[model samples]
Target chain A: MTSLTQQLVDALGIMVLGMGLVFLFLGILILGVELVARCLSRANEASTPSMSEQPMPALDSRLVAAISSAVHQYRASA
Target chain B: MDGLMAFWAETGIAHFTPGQMLMMAVGGLLLYLAIVRGFEPLLLLPIGFGAVLANIPHAGFTEEGGMLYYAYHVGIETGVFPLLIFMGVGALTDFGALIANPKTLLLGAAAQFGIFATLIGAIALNLVPGFEFSMKDAAAIAIIGGADGPTAIFLASKLAPELLGAIAVAAYSYMALVPIIQPPIMRLLTTQAEREIKMEQLREVSKKEKVIFPLMVLGLTILFLPAATPLVGMFCLGNLMRESGVVDRLSKTAQNELINIVTIFLGLAVGSKLSAAQFLRQETLGILLLGAVAFGIGTATGVLMAKLMCKLSGGKVNPLIGAAGVSAVPMAARVVNKVGLEANQHNYLLMHAMGPNVAGVLGSAVAAGILLAVLG
Candidate 1:
């Protein structure tokens, strides 16, 4: 009878402590991961311009003409 | 005539006991499930074969100085195989999704609630006669909820070696049945609108972040929970090797060849424990029932957590992906995607679900460490 009582007490202790610690550990992990990501992205931004932020490079008139003409020829043949 | 009788008595057929025959039949059933039903054949096939070998009368396969005896002591008793397997799992896994959505870490933690919940349930079962489960035994049994076969086996070996066979079998079987057992619980816990909630696309994680992730995880684990370091450290080592890109050879071997060999031996060692006396008990039945319940509770908690996050995050999160927190790896994530697709065809939650799915692996290891610390 004493053994069962002790086990029940221990079970409750584990349930509380286990869930609390798991959440605590993972919670800290979430922060750590987010912090690391922020630092890395910051370093990346300092070194190179982002693709989205960069203006599109203007195409040369000659290249555009060639491309348009090729498309036109393909369309006409089809 | 006396010499002939002596030879006949030594034969397996002449010496076979009914218990041995029944255990062999169980082993055959595992093989059938592995080959014909295609259920976790990588581990199940070897395990089933080991069971058959162990049950052969007069073979002494599980006796001292035997192959199984050595495998069990060398691999399971020292808790080496599962840690090696964890390293392989780390090398194979991609944490980019988890890193992209850090909030999903809570979902992973929440899913582990099942392990603790089942711990209570196991102890409660003692109210019935003929069941004599100690706190350690209950802790070992409850880990079947973690849904990670290696982690369950490791804990069972430590806390209750006698229960290792039943625990490992239940863990793997429930994991294989995740697709079947999880859907109904997921649907019951969530609404159609919640299932179809499309998450924003995850950002592209940088190479530097990828390389640092495993190290950071190891650092945190070592600092906070040193007991978990064996499992988490090996996993981090494998991930670091892969992410560093400097040791592709080591990483490849760890993920492919090394893991494959360890898995074979681990399966056989676990199966060797399935001898008739240890396995054919009412306790085995109790362990199986608790295992299924643990999985169900884990699935429910995961879904409920996701629902809470969805509500908290203004419905940007799909509650279905929470079920992946049970850590059945790609299978749980795939089921989440399927359920999401059912709610809305255009909803592709596979990548999103991967975040919680992998987080589940880490969550279970942490849960195992807590069990070991408290109960060991």
Candidate 2:
């Protein structure tokens, strides 16, 4: 059986590996968000007529969250 | 008359002994600093009270059967309070800013370079007289660089509770000093224009993103560092409770009432460790001196990394926000914002800085976990 020290060493190695993974995940997440933003802006450019008139109100989050939770509860009831 | 004189000499004038009197007085000084000057009042209040309690000559308060000793045993020795504090922090934090600007994580990661560097410095200091430090002790000591109280307390309590007195004081003192220590380093590292650089407005962070973010973070922590799970998991739970839209009452209590209660007990218990025999030593002085060095190096490294990021991104990042990468949370971020306004009134860096500010908390907790894994 592995001694506690060996187990601890193994854990240390895993944690280091995990930190690297966190960095990678964060990097990928940033890139993905930026790319989606580009696609979204492009879609807006193609669909809209005026170059700049009045921007649409950004997605209202609190409303959506409330609606979603209410629907979820309703579904549960049903 | 001789008997009365002897009793008075033993019990009245000579009762305290010099060391006991000095430590007891130090406790009162701490209280004055906390209440009047407002130096980390949440922590300093309890710590001061505990210090007074501990140093009352032959109090037996922090002895084996003492109340403070029992409190320490139940909460700190078991490493429960810091974990709970982490949970409250997680519940209170709004992670949408981090998710909106994930690039800020780099600044957060860059700041932790201080803790590791200070670890080496601490080991070197072990060569000094009155300082007998092991690798575990050095790691615990260096976590003051993280500018994180719970992480410092968590690591010190586990790796070197003997050093808990110095470490806790160092951690909170530096945390309170963030407004003082960070600005000069920030100004030194960044040009006036770089300090004034205004970040583009952050995109609206969707609530869905906010809710899922904690879960994703918790998943990562569990997979990567189980030792950090207590700190990280509790933090995630707190954030989840806040974001879930389902448990506002529990979330509110956790953030306000629970955290306040824990802070009082935690501060007192930590203070109780600061007896004259433990705290008023040459080694404690060394810990205090090295703590400043660690915080300075950490801040400088973070600023340097932000400078690098600015160069890479063609001056998109305000290097001043790099100073916020230490885990003093909104305090560090507010200083960045205040400095930004001084440089240019139109510049608003608070929201942007908060992304890295909160991320620093996670990064430090992770770094603390790494230390625990190695040392514990």
Which candidate number would show the highest TM-score if scored against the true structure?
1
**Relative to the true structure, how large is the alpha-carbon lDDT of every model?**
0.92, 0.82
Please report the candidate that would top lDDT against the real structure: 1
lDDT of 1 by residue, B1-376 (tens): 9999999999999988898999999999999999999998998999999999999988888999999999999999999999899999999999999999989989899999899999999999998899999888999999998899889988998999999999999999888899899999999999887877888999998788899889998999889998888888998999999999999999999999999999999989888998999999999999999999999999999999999999898899999999999998989999999999999999999999999999999999999988887778
Per-residue error at B219 for model 1, in Å?
Answer: 0.8
Model 2 chain B scores worst on lDDT over the 10 consecutive residues at: B123-132
DockQ, candidate no. 1: 0.64
Note the residue pairs that clash in candidate 2. B87-B234, B90-B239, B91-B238, B91-B239
Chain A TM-score of model 1 versus the true structure? Answer: 0.58
Using all chains and alpha carbons, the TM-scores for the candidates as numbered come to 0.93, 0.84
**Could you give the C-alpha RMSD of every candidate to the true structure, in order shown?**
5.3, 8.8
Error of 1 at B193 (Å): 1.1
For the candidates in turn, chain A alone yields TM-scores of 0.58, 0.51
